[model samples]
Target: MIVFLCVRFLVFSFVWPFIGGWREMYAANDAIPLFINMDYMKDPRYFAISFRRFFKNFLNNEDLRPGIYELRFSKPEKVCVLENSVLSSERTLDVIAYAPRDLATENGVSFEKEIYVRGSAAIGQNNDLRALVCDGDVSLAKNTVLRRWLDAEGNISAGEGCNLGVSLTSGKECLVAAGCVFRRLYGAPVKAGTSRKKSFALAARDDEERVFPPPPLGAKERQLEEIWPYSDTRFSVITPNRLWVGANSRILGHIKTYGNLNVDDNVLITGNVFAEGDIVIGQFCKILGDIFAQGSVSIGEGSQVGRPGKIKSVVGNQTVFLSSGAAVYGYVTTEGDGRVL
Candidate 1:
């Protein structure tokens, strides 16, 4: 009995390691691998592109002419296709409407689904919409409420007291009137409370060769003692305290401030801007690069960020306010509210 017990113990000890190894290998093989592609999902036009693809594929399988029809998808989906322009006023649309030409809506219209217009689109006052995609220009009247997003291949104009929803993007210019609110905006040049012609005229009238004032005396003594270098621009300036730049001043380098930053009228900054606190930009200023603020940001009238061909960003952790005639070439975003005044 004693010899048998010793043999059993040895056998069990020798086999347990092999069994555990096998179990570990099996568990590894049973594990699932996950891959996530966030680029497409993060795109601002993701919904619009996806819907366009689906509609095109659906059209390919059908031989229906231009008219209103009930499409049978997983569920019954209503569709309206118009060869000529669409004029829907004081009505409710529960269908996905498509117009190869222009589209116009009157006051008190409610759109429950997406709309696609190959030509221009004019949305009237007091309208509620889900989404809109236009190949040409788009104009939204006063007090319109967009629930999802709006995208245009040409230009976009939103009137007063409009809610622009999650995202508003334009291929060319984007003009937003007063009392409009939005989350994200992207465009070649986004102008608030001004027309394209007027903005251009203002720019043209400004002195192209105007000289910028030199940096304030004893500026270096006031700045934080750290000298950070930028690889691309090779210019950086840092301040540990509140920063205030006088009118018509020019900063040839990037500015980083720990406290609030205030710039007076007609300032020109050649590089990026970073502020831990609130940032207030005065009128007719031009910032060549991005602006990032941990607190709220207020852009004064006629200020421009980024050049015509270049793209830049203005991002505020809190609210972002754009005064009349302010322009951002690429993107304007805020975690809280974004308003045009």
Candidate 2:
């Protein structure tokens, strides 16, 4: 009996997280339905990826979007918030779910049972709660930095010459290309120096001291404290050694590939003519173009694949989009089959 109990406990510990998240995710029809602008771009394909993520996150399948406030969540009972509706806000965000649940996607499957939107639409702000904010104007380039506190926020960033939803922290740097988005959901606090009377710039390799440099007039190219262009891409091509896209980033255009592709979340692709390497695109990727993978391709979540995003078909070997939320819109005549997400 003792040995049996030990074995049972061990198994429970190892498998409980995934199993529990799965059951809780798919428990009902009103679990976690994603909310996105269906009218933005491609029709069903867009929803396919977003919907899959909504369910998975609700079911504990994946991470939450970066800039989320009261991500409406409920207890054991199925709850919902319909469109053309509003939700009231909670101070300090009194809503947080620690319970384990199953994570899965229902796709277009039917649902039966109970789901009640218990509370009225709530919307408000909490001081102690975390918030996501852009470093500067939304249209600014990668060299720009918004102000935040490291004590209260975290930063995500993208390469230079890119439109990002990510954050960039002080004394640190990230390299991203143009037209990329860095969406940061969690924020950190900004560091404060004793020189509250004026602004000072920190040295390149040192974080403890400040250096005096020629002051820039309002017209002298907005001088950033920790920002400087390191390279020039005007005469050459902008190519990252590796490419990775997060789930929440709203992206378009065909990214040229010579290495690895790791895509998660709802990635909107206009498609590419040629891509050579191991490819992994999660959730929904509206292919308005064609994708030719010279290596393995793995698709995950409830993403819509092929066609619309690619413009043609997907041809490759060792490819797979194995997930309850997996969907492909393009033509797949490849010989690859792996788990989706």
Which one is best on TM-score?
Answer: 1
On residues 1-341, what C-alpha lDDT tens digit does candidate 2 reach at each position? 99999989988888876886777778855676688867687321232234334544664644333232344434343322233222232211223221121111111111122111212111122112121122221112233322221111112232233322122221111222332222221111111111112111111112213222322222221111111122111111113444565554433334545666676555554335244677776554433345567776654544444322122344556553333333333234345332212
- List, residue by residue over 132-209, the lDDT tens digit for candidate 1: 989899999999999989999989999999999988988899999999999889888888995675443222245343
Least lDDT summed over 10 consecutive residues: which range in candidate 2?
187-196
* Clashes, model 2: 81
Q: Which stretches of candidate 1 lie over 4 Å from their true place?
A: 1-35, 38-42, 61-64, 69-76, 198-235
lDDT for residue 37 in candidate 2, whole number 0-100: 65
Question: Model 1, residue 95: displacement in angstroms?
Answer: 1.4
Off by over 4 Å in 2: 1-240, 306-311, 336-341
User: Each model's C-alpha lDDT?
Assistant: 0.81, 0.33
